[model samples]
Target: MTDGVPTWEEIARDHGRFLYAVAYRLSGNDDEAQDLVQESLIRVRRGLERYEPGSLEGWLARIVTNVFLDEMRRRKRRPTDALPDDPERVLPAAPAADEVYVGLSDDIQAALSALPEEFRVPVVMCDVADQSYEQIAEALGVPVGTVRSRLHRGRKLLREMLSEHAA
Candidate 1:
């Protein structure tokens, strides 16, 4: 935090978990979250000079979100084929037993992932990233009212989904 601007390493060391949590909430997949964090860091490094002093995490959240949206747009433009689910296909290796999983429950994660992007982004930004509606609105280029509306709708959807799952 020298000169009111953190070095790249300092940002990563201090805020990596925060970045990853936001990314994971947005993407709903570990691999995609990792990629989002990596891309966000790259963007942060490049844009550091122009970054203002207030709310570094907010800035990082915006970067990660933009990266996720860009990738979604790119995927839409050039959609990939899904491989057939074969019964005998080998699954990827599991995480180490000692590794901690500090995320939403599987059912909650699925419900959140099921949300449309318009709703999900606001929910993740407001809840997962702990960002203010004004900050989210500013980052998303939407009105604060819109952020509130979407967040409300998104939470409603999640509640319905989770209740159904519980039933």
Candidate 2:
């Protein structure tokens, strides 16, 4: 805790990596993840005073998620052309671990990206961000049962997509 004011820079310094993880899992790209984190920081700064003490990480993750969802809504309203990309240009550097495992994560991200926003948000909140059903429900303004069903369906779809890619 620095002097009196809780600066966004301090929050970014402490929680940037976690924010990046959440953003990356949601957006599936480095640039979008960075933008999401940046936007979340801005929102956090505006609301920092009202921020409660417990689960700061959770609060930040929720902000990132909200920002991402808002962008998705805006994009839907103003559809843009998606430039075709060369596969080579899109691929990430190889990870240190098993190639198959790394590819699986990429596959999961692709599948997650393809899911409906409702399913995708809950699944990422519960599975990727490690939030509980109650937290996910609250963040999504839904019930626990709704969150559970969405997560279940999301995981099932992800499995099917990954298996098809493996074949």
Candidate 3:
């Protein structure tokens, strides 16, 4: 971190997992999360010169979110057809034998994915990314009150969905 600004390599090496976690929570899938991280890194490289020294993770989160929202908007404008689930298609490898299963986390993740984007983004930003309301509002270009409202509503929705599953 020279001059209080992280170099691109340093940022990637230090915050790679953090970036992936936030990306995964936002996108709800591994492939999209990987893409988001890659794109975010590219943007970081380009904008490194302009980056101010404060809340590096917050800046990265904002970049990841902007990339996600941009992709969402583009998809909405030009939707694509889903690929047919062909029997001949390759399947992902099963989890390793050493891995422990946690059912509740899966359920929570599914419920989160099911949320509407408006609610989901704030939820992930606050709960997963550990961003502040002001940071979230700045990243999302909304009022702080709106961020708080969406976070409350998003948590309520998640609780309801989880309760339904529990019952």
Instruction: Summarize candidate 1's per-residue lDDT along 69-104 as a digit string, tens digits.
Output: 888888778665223256443353364453335544
Clashes in each model (backbone N, CA, C under 3 Å)?
Answer: 0, 0, 0
Candidate 1 vs 2: which has more lDDT: 1
Models 1 onward score TM values of 0.86, 0.80, 0.88
Where does candidate 3 stray beyond 4 Å?
Answer: 81-101
- Please write out the lDDT profile of model 3 over residues 1-167, one tens digit for every residue: 78999999999999998899889888876767889999999999999999999988898989999999988998787665223256443464354553333999778778999999999999999988899999999989899999999999999999999999999
Model 1, 1: alpha-carbon shift in Å?
A: 3.9
Query: Quick one: best TM-score, which candidate?
Result: 3
Which runs in model 2 stand beyond 4 Å of their true positions? 2-6, 80-101
Pitting candidate 1 against candidate 2, the one with the higher TM-score is 1
Pull out the clashing pairs in model 3: none
lDDT of 2 by residue, 69-111 (tens): 8888887776652332556745565543532345567788888
Model 1 worst lDDT run, 10 consecutive residues: 81-90
> Mind sharing the TM-score for model 3?
0.88
Off by over 4 Å in 1: 81-104
- Return the top candidate by lDDT: 3
